[model samples]
Target: MDVSQRLSFFAALFKVHENPTTGMWLLYITIVLLSILVFKLGFAKKLPIIKSAVIYTFLILGCTVLTFLGVFLPVAEGLVVAALILIIYKIRLHQEKKEQAKAE
Candidate 1:
């Protein structure tokens, strides 16, 4: 298969193979930021400072692996989609609650 065809969206956008260090780091940062946003918006629950720190530390470590997978898979793209879906769901949920409050 063609290399261009196999590269993931962010990978191709950053030209990972062409720029090696810079591109890979940029791709990795993109994946990490997206993953953190998704986790905060969709999955995180309030936690104490230490616990939150630990969780994020592990999450960043996990993103390193994700960065590798993201080169060929749509991992970052999937995270972006997931984050958008969560944002929409949260907005709708908040509106419903507000409407119910007003009706009460």
Candidate 2:
């Protein structure tokens, strides 16, 4: 509509990390990458380091796009959700490990 609104829209689309909330996004991404590495390392897999790195790169870009779409009321909310997901994943994994130990 107006020039200012147009500019803001474009900024949000391209400037994800410019917002402080993007820190949460980065944290979630880091967690995902680290988890992948841990899994591969545990199994003695070759560790597709290069491929996994690229995958994370694309995922970050995708999240930025989704953030711009107003998908989560200023994007920070999405970051919080991502963090929660990571927490849940870690908790579940810990429980599973405990169960396996008992069985063993």
Q: Rate the local accuracy (lDDT) of all candidates.
A: 0.93, 0.51
lDDT of 1 by residue, 27-64 (tens): 98998899899999989999999999999999999999
lDDT by residue (1-104, candidate 2, tens digit) is: 54334333323444434564664455445444543444443333344889767765765566555544442243444344555676677789999999999999
Off by over 4 Å in 1: none
- Best model per lDDT: 1
RMSD of 1: 1.0
Q: Which ten residues in a row have the lowest lDDT in candidate 2?
A: 2-11
